[model samples]
Target: MNWQDQYQRWKNDQDLEPQLKEALHNMNENEIEAAFSGTLEFGTGGMRGVLGPGTNRMNVYTVRKAAKGLALYLEEQGMADRGVAVAYDSRYQSREFAVETAKVLGVHGIKTYVFTGVRPTPTLSFAVRHLEAGAGVMITASHNPPEYNGYKVYNEQGAQLPPAQADQMIEQVNTVADELAIAVKDQSEIEAEGLINWIDEAVDEAYLRELKSITYRDDVKRDLSIVFTSLHGTAHNLATRSLAQAGFDHVFAVSEQVEEDPEFSTVKSPNPEEHQAFEYAIAKGQDVDADVLVATDPDADRLGVAAKKADGEYHVLTGNQLGALMLDYKLANMDDVPRNSVMINTIVTSQLGKAVADHYNVTTEHTLTGFKFIAEKIEEYNQSGAHEFVFGYEESYGYLVEDFARDKDAIQSTLLACEMAAYYREQGMTLFDALEQFFERHGYYFEDLHSLKLEGTDGPEQINAIMEDFRFNPVEGAIAVEDYLTGKRTYLESGESVDLNLPASNVVKFWLDDDTWCCLRPSGTEPKMKFYFAVKGETREAADERLKQLKDRVLERL
Candidate 1:
């Protein structure tokens, strides 16, 4: 049916919820068209969209459809009896949506273990394995704005559904012809039948015990003053407790952002990557004379840090810088470095990480831009025994310290970061000073990310046009091009082509003669095209200049 007809059908449905009916009545023609244009996409990352009433938004109907699809897929595999785990963050309707998912799965005779309250995304990943469930579902949008929400699925290994399994899940999700027609049992009925189990502190204690196991240095000077903020999402309580349990006594919590507020009213955006998100935390840091400050996003999977410099001003560290610092600290302090240890990062990540790994005699591996790919390698190494998984990180503020959680764990990273800062403090230096020393030892490495947001109906077409333009056209000063969509790397100088040996994705990377590189890829979870640039030089000024020039040249073509 056309969008207009679909809009009318939704408007005319008597059983629609009051909130959706009110939203439908208030929407204009353009809003109606956008809402009914098509179903929200369920990709490898699962589905994410604005919160509202429509096929294209994140509502109860769409969530139910997704749950039903997962149920059918599990039943088909004869794994429904193994049960599924469900968790959500502090977003609006997150708990409601999670309960609705449980209801749908319950009606299909599938068991579910649902969290009693909000939990971090990484905890949900751990729950899947700890519970020995067949699958897992987390209701979150990570660091997206307050108006957005999402649903992510995980395999039995506690990792995000990989491409092959995701494709099959997408096929199952598409089989449900009508989103509004999926039936769900009442919550009470499901509870009475033992189909739904509520999980709380038992799992929390187990996860925390595992997190404490990752800490290596308990003898470091614990006198460091730290400021922490959850940005009004989950992780405030757990984060504070984790630090205290690890023997850090001077931790200060950002009072304004510590509570679980769905609106995230304290900051303009809940994302910790942006410097503006640290306004309250920085203020708290200044008030307490904190040696370092940390902020986690809504789901608490990604961490951001700002450390005090000699000038008494705080400098925010990029994801790449923090990853290198963490890796260096971990390897430097290890009593004995494992011979077969390996570190994993994405293709777009800075080369500095690989440099650090090489210094420690640890191997490095590269994957696509998702943590799941990194987790996939960890699982592979677990079975093959070729390499021990040491660390994993991506440029977009995600890091994984251990394989206990298949996704990024900001809690784990936060604890270790505090210890690293304290250990450096004993040397009478700050993290900023350590970072400069790191740059002096290694080449001055710099990186930046630029995103172009394109929303509405024509957004996808415009993005596709840009991708096609770069694919067929020759870029200036380019030596070779790696097109992940075609799974080939072609040398422009000679017409030689070779396989990338990675799964196909819509990413294109350029290798330049000057040793600087850039990559262009559409975000798998958002409606934006991201440009990643990295460069290294003998001096900081030279690296900064080269990075700017590379960004200018690449963006001018778009």
Candidate 2:
């Protein structure tokens, strides 16, 4: 059916929610068309959308449908007997969604473990593995605005379902012909029947126990002064507790954003990717002369840091810089660690991390642009015993040191960052000075990210057009192009194309002369097209300028 048919169905339905019916009655034809034009597609990260009525929205009926489909998929996988773990963030209707998911799965006779309250994404991943469940669900949109919520699926391995599995799940989600027909048990009935169990402190304690192993130097934590903010999400107590447990004495929390708020009252966006999220943390850091400022996104899966620079002002470190520092520290300190240790990072991340890994004589592997890919790699290594999993990170402020959880952990990252600061202080050098030394030894590598926001309706088409332009037209200053979707690299000069072994994704990267490169990929979690530029030069300033030039040249085309 077309938009008109869906709109008519909504208008004629008696079971539709009242507010949604009122909104639909008030909407114009164009608005109605947009709302019912298509079903919200579930990507590798799962479904996320505005909380309202429509095929494009996330609501109870939609949640029921997704859960029913997920249940069917799990049953087919012979995982119905293994059960599932469920967790949620502090988004509006998040708890409702979590309970609703449990109800649907329970009605299917699949046992479910639901958190008693809001929790982080990594904890949910850990719960799946710890409980020996077949799968997991996290009801969150990560750092998206309060208006949005999401549903994420994890496999038995504790990683987000890979692309192929996600496609299978999506097919199941699409197969539910009637949303209202999805089976669900009464909440009280499910609880009484013991089909749904509530998990609380035990999971948290086990997760923290795993984090203790991340400490490289016990002495460094004692002297580190760290400021951390959770941006009004679920990470407040967990991060602070982890820091103190790691022996960090002087740690401050942002008072205003410490409490759980679905609206994320303090900051415009809860995302760590935005520098504005660090405003409160930065001010507190300056007031106390903190060694570093750390902020976690909602659900505590991503980490961002602000450090005091040589110029005596606080500067936010990009994901790449922080990843480099942590990679170096983790690899160098692995004196007694397994010799075949491996570190994983995304393809779009800074090549500087690869350099650091090479310096430590550790293998660095590149994956598709998500922490799930990194987690998948970790599971692979753990099973094969061919490589020891060391560290994993991505360019978007996501880092995982210990695989206690199958996802990034801001709590673990915060403690480790503080420890690194203390260690550098004992060495009589600041992190900024250490960064400079690193640049001098390795060639100066600077990276810049440009996000082009294209709002609703035609946004996806516009993003696709932009990607198509690059795929067809040879980049002016590029010597080669790596198209991830086709899993091949095209060399312009030699007219040679080599197969790239990584998983397929809609990403195009240009490799230029002089160690300069640019990459283009649509944001999986937002309505934006992201461009990444990396440049190398003799000095940091020169490299930054070159990076800016490259960004300007590519963005102009967009």
Best by lDDT: 1
Superposition TM-score, candidate 2 onto the true structure: 0.97
Runs in model 2 lying further than 4 Å from the true structure: 18-30
Report the poorest 10 consecutive residues by lDDT, candidate 1.
511-520
State the C-alpha lDDT per candidate: 0.92, 0.87
Lowest-lDDT window of 10 residues in candidate 2?
216-225
lDDT by residue (393-503, candidate 2, tens digit) is 998898888887888878788877878878898887778878888999888989888789999778989999999999998568889999999999989989899999998
TM-score of each: 0.98, 0.97
Distance from true position, residue 122, model 2, in Å?
0.8
Q: Number of clashes in every candidate structure?
A: 0, 0
Which ranges of candidate 1 are over 4 A from the true structure? Answer: none
